[model samples]
Target chain A: MKKLINAVEDVVVDSLRGVAAAHPDSLKVDLDHRIVLRASGPVDGKVGLVSGGGSGHEPLHSGYVGRGMLDAACCGEVFTSPVPDQITEATKAVDGGAGVLHIVKNYTGDVMNFDMAAEMASMEAGTRVESVVIADDVAVQDSLYTAGRRGVGLTVLAEKILGAAAEEKRDLDALLALAQRINEGGRSFGVALTSCTVPAAGKPTFDLSDNEMELGVGIHGEPGRETTTLGTAADVASQIVEPILADRDFTASPVIAMLNGMGGTPLIEQYLVWGEIAKILAGKGVTVARTLVGNHITSLEMAGCSLTLLSADDDLLTLWDAPVETPGLRWGC
Target chain B: MKKLINAVEDVVVDSLRGVAAAHPDSLKVDLDHRIVLRASGPVDGKVGLVSGGGSGHEPLHSGYVGRGMLDAACCGEVFTSPVPDQITEATKAVDGGAGVLHIVKNYTGDVMNFDMAAEMASMEAGTRVESVVIADDVAVQDSLYTAGRRGVGLTVLAEKILGAAAEEKRDLDALLALAQRINEGGRSFGVALTSCTVPAAGKPTFDLSDNEMELGVGIHGEPGRETTTLGTAADVASQIVEPILADRDFTASPVIAMLNGMGGTPLIEQYLVWGEIAKILAGKGVTVARTLVGNHITSLEMAGCSLTLLSADDDLLTLWDAPVETPGLRWGC
Candidate 1:
């Protein structure tokens, strides 16, 4: 594969080394265990937040490890879930007097691993841990790597919102309830203009013709719902938004809309798509209170975009507007 | 070309509409003039900073407009310089009681256009405008789009540093001197793994074989020094760094280094490449005090990375650490 990696097996660790080097003062890396932790240890009475999955969706878990975000991120191999031991270690490392919150995407491997780690942490360290799954992707009922709806873009929002609550000294149960409420409120759908190659596979995970696209693709380049001819940005926005609006009732409050790029697209194209999406949302009478447009959570070099709409009240909005000092998403600090 | 655009001609304006839609509160768009201005207009007496080039290199001009950064950005068409009228409009619009600073990249068209605009503003609006041209690309003595050197990654650093200086109410002469210093202290080099396709061009800008890559490539897919076989990230790091070191001595002070991605390269690969660059810089006794790794200034969907080293003093460091609330580079606010 034409990637900037040293070797197939060393991609995750090498990138982590770079992450550590770039933000040495703000982050500390456990090279042997493959966990990224905040440089300053966890607070005494604050609930510790931890979230991770595969390595390729960058700025996701690892880039979010800082103040107003996660305390630790357990990174696995590219597109592979972290093992139980890594998660268990991160659970114990971020644990303070307050409990730990495990924010997981709705992949089968991720769900199982985080569950096992939670069990292990409770049994071995005597730390109370609560696990929450994010299943916002409305792409399919099940995909190659996931059971239920795949957790795609909502995980990023979940981390930020829940991390703020954790920083406010919310207990584990309160955080768990907030996580579930967010899980029910937000929904995401993705499209792929081109497929991406995994380091181990060395070839595109799926194939698409020059004029075709994969609607509702997973974050790992798995098979999307349909492969169809590509359309204009306006038409593409309708395809993504109609399904999301049909799936949920977002009229209760203004929405926090995220137009996320699936790696290989440019900010220009992302903005073009977001412009059309905003027009469509306005036509549907949905006020976009806040909007984010970029590659915050991305598949590895896949050219596409995803849309996530989170129904929010003042509380959720306030938490989202709180100071976050992470690598990927930072503001108000 | 497989792109998510409605029509090739509408790319720039359509995307600006998206930018306006995404950041309505912090940004105000002049659709007729294609200028992005701060929603909260120019400060009463701050030296307004305005910088922009072609449209493809995003988060470069538009994303840098905000408090403690730029007061305005004049976006040109993709890979093309903005006209003099747009620049004159932006110059007058962002001019408070104080003067204005025009940070132009050293491309021929950009220099000529901004110069004409500065002259026009002086004659028509009686606004004192000082221009600083950044020519920091270390790749070639001359390139396809530029006369002496292509201003690439260093423009981002110049905007940020100069913007911070302007925020402190520096006069036009002081900001111009600081701009010259930053322009002298910074140097950049880039490489392209594959050519980028301009939407209007309907094809890749250049051709490269699977095993070949363009070393010292320009930001706009202009021919670099050579097209050689692709190497490991570490080897590639040496190719970019050795020339920069030979050209200038960076051992005098710790430098702020930016490992920037050309749109298509994922963050994982960017970090992997940055990791190798860090090792080489350390070996050369060049201390890296601060590092930024992401697609700050990108060329559409080009697959590549560029490095910028800006020699910094404590004042520049403090300004760099100051609060910036723009969409692209937001921190410490």
Candidate 2:
């Protein structure tokens, strides 16, 4: 693997060091705990938002740590869940007087580890913690690392919306209800033209023929619905959007659409696919209120794209439009 | 190639359709001319900014067409310069009462075409136009596409700083001077681990063995200084930074650094490489005032990165901190 990295074991810490060096005004990093915290965080009487997962999907957890997004992100090794100790430290570091909310993806390891950390934080430090597991990927009911459905691109949306709500000082209960509502309203599906190589593995996670693609691959190269021959951008857009639209009826409310790149795809192709998807959505009478087109959540350098649609109302749209200052997603700030 | 495209000839137009569909609120697309214009442009007496080049280096010209940025971007075919007609149309479309400024990169075709467009706009439409050609790449004295130097990553920084100045109602003369100052103060260098495939080419632009890399490579896979064996991130960081520091002294003033991805490299590795770069800069006493770490200007899906450092004074730093809302870069909207 010709990656721009030093030793494989130092990847996560070294990246965190870069994050710390890059965003000294906005982000604070704890190299010992592998947690990234907001530089000006733990506001008194404000709800603290925390989320984390594996490392490869960047600008997701750690990159989202800032004023209007996440208060802290507990980063794990590449494609590996952060230990319970790391999560506990992150929760404690961000807990204000109000409470802490853990925004987690629906991986079995992540779910269990976050749960254990929540218990530890509450029992040891009297910090009230709530967890919301995002399982918005409609690609598969079960995956290699997940039980029900994998949490894919929707985690980025959930973090933004919830972060805005938390910034509004919503109590932990209200934030919990909003998180569940977001999880219900969102659906995602991905396709991988190539597999990503982990730093430790030093080889591609899986093999894909040049003419073939994984139709509904998970973020970590998990087996998808099927492997199919490559098609045109229009066909790929339909294949991605059809499953998402079928999984949920988005015609009722205005939807927030995200045409996210799976790390390796360029923005030109992302926009092209987004154009086709927009046409399909408009034809199907779905009103898209807002759209985000870029790489928000990714699986290392996997060359594919994913579509996530959230059936949004005016309130959710307002929250999304509110000022956010994270490195991954920022606007109106 | 396994690109998400409809056809080889339609890549530029189709991608523009997606861009138009994605950012309707902020951008307007002239499908016939293949120009992306700001939706709220021609601001009475504000000096207009127009920039364009080839299509493959995305988010370079087109994606920067929004508030506090370029007023128009002419989209050429992949790796091909925009014709004089397209540039002239874009110039006329964005020419306010004050004047219009053309930000042209140093590529031979681009420089020539933009010059022709400036003359056409001045002669045919009686619109005043001024041009500033940027050649900031220190990789080589000349390349296949450029006369003096390849305008690699510095175009992004120049557009942003100049865009902010234009928003402040700087006239064409002042904007031209500022653009020249920015071009003089900035230096860029790139490395490519693998090559990218153009849609029309249907194959990789260049080849490199698994353990080899092209150091000081041009943005369009132009031959670099040499093909060297791959090194660790620390060694690669030194290899990139040494030549830049040798060419210019960044320690005298604050620097705005951008560690940009060459499209296909993932953020994890980019940050890891950035960590080492930060160490080198700090050790060398280069005070970085602002840092941008992600894909800004890209060369399709080439797997590598480039570093851009713009030595800035107080005025330029203030301009750099101004609000910019574009599909490629958005902050403090």
Candidate 3:
């Protein structure tokens, strides 16, 4: 594998160190606990948003930490869940007088560990922590790294919208409701042009011919539900968007959509994909209110793209447009 | 060789269509001329900022066409400089009565085209257009795509800061002075871990072994000064920054630094590389007043990073901190 890393074992820590050095003003990295916390954390009377999963889907949990986003993000090893201790520490660290919310993606290990951490926080620190599981990926019902639907691009939308609400001092119950609303309202579908190499594995997670693509691929290089010959951006976009619209009725509200690049796809292709997705969505009588197109949630060096559509009411749209200052997604700050 | 495109020849136009569709609110595309013009273009009496190059280095030109960044950007085919006709149309479109500034990268074709466009604008539209060629890459004395130094990451910096200056009603001459100052003060060096494939070429631009890297590689996959074994991020960072400091004396003032990822490198790795670069700069007593870390000036899907440093005065820093609202770089909008 041709990765710019020191050693396989050192990948996560080394990367975390870099994260710390880059955004010294906005974030503070707890080197020992492996949690990225808001530099000025535990803001009194503000609900603390905490979310994390595997490390490879970058700018996801970590990059979402700052004003109007997560108060802390527990960084796990690549494609691996953070240990309960790490999650527990993060829960305590970000807790203000207002309680904490743990945004766990719907992966078996992540769910289990976050659940344990929430319970531990409640019992030991008496910090009321609520956990919401995100399962937005409409790929496989179950996958190699997940028990049910994988939490994919919706995590980004959820973080941005919910982070805004949290900044407004939304209570834990209200924030939890918003989280559930986002999870239920959003759906995601992904396609992979190439498999990403996990540093430890030192090889592509999977292989495909030049003409093939893995439809419905997961962020961790998990085997997609279907494999097929690659097609034009418009054709590929139709396939991905069809699965999403079939799974839900998004016409009830204007949707906030994201055409996120899996790490290696160039922006040009992503935009082209977005153009086709927009045309398709327009034809379906669906109006997209807010659009985010980039590699916001990405697998490490995986060549593919994912689409997330979240049915938005005025409230969610307002929250999404709210100022957010973070490493990954920053605007109006 | 794999890419998500329709016909190879349709890449640029299809991608521009995507761009025009995606950012309709902030930008309007001249479909015929292949220019990305600000939706509200050429404010009367305001200095117009125009830039462009080959299509692959995204967010460099098109993504930057918005309020406080660029008035317009001419789009070219993949890895090809825009023809003089396209540049000439863009010049006349964004003339704004005050004048137009042509920000051209130092590639031979780009320089030739922009020069010809400037003369055409003067003759046909009576628009005073001044061109500032950015040749910041300190990798090679000459390159395959360029006669002298290839413009790399510094073009982004110049556009951002100079755009702000122009937005504040800095006249053509002052903006030109600022641009020249920035071009002289800035330097960039890039390294490529893997070559990017131009969809039209249907293959990688160059080749590297699993353990090898191209040091000081140009944005368009031109050969660097050296090819060596892949090293740790710190070692790589040291290699990149050393030659830059040796080329000029940046100790007299605080520098603005950007650790830019060539499209394919993951954000985590980019931050890690930034961590190493920041440390080395600190050790060398070079105070970095501002830092930007991301794939702002990408080379298609090339897996690597580049470093750009510009000596910043208070005026430049103030302009740098000014609000910019663009698809690629947006802040304080």
TM-score per candidate: 0.99, 0.99, 0.99
TM-score, candidate 1, is 0.99
lDDT tens per residue, model 1, A255-297: 9989999999999999999999999999998989989899989
**Candidate 1, which segments miss by more than 4 Å at Cα?**
none
Docking class of 1: high
The runs of at least 3 residues in candidate 3 whose Cα sits more than 4 Å from the true structure, single-residue gaps closed, are none
- DockQ-based class of model 3: medium
Model 1 interface DockQ: 0.87
lDDT of 3 by residue, A1-333 (tens): 888777788888888888888788889999898899999878999988899988988888898899988899999999899999999999998889799999888899999999999999989999998988999999889888788899889999998998999999989999999999999999999999999988888888899898899999988878877889998888999989999999999999999999999999999999888888999999999998888989999999999999999999999999999998888887888
Return the lDDT, model 1, position A158: 92
Ranked by DockQ, the better of candidates 2 and 3 is 2
Find the candidate with the highest lDDT and give its number: 2
The alpha-carbon lDDT assigned to residue B317 of candidate 2 equals 94
TM-score of chain A for the candidates in order shown:
0.99, 0.99, 0.99
Candidate numbers sorted by lDDT from highest down: 2, 1, 3
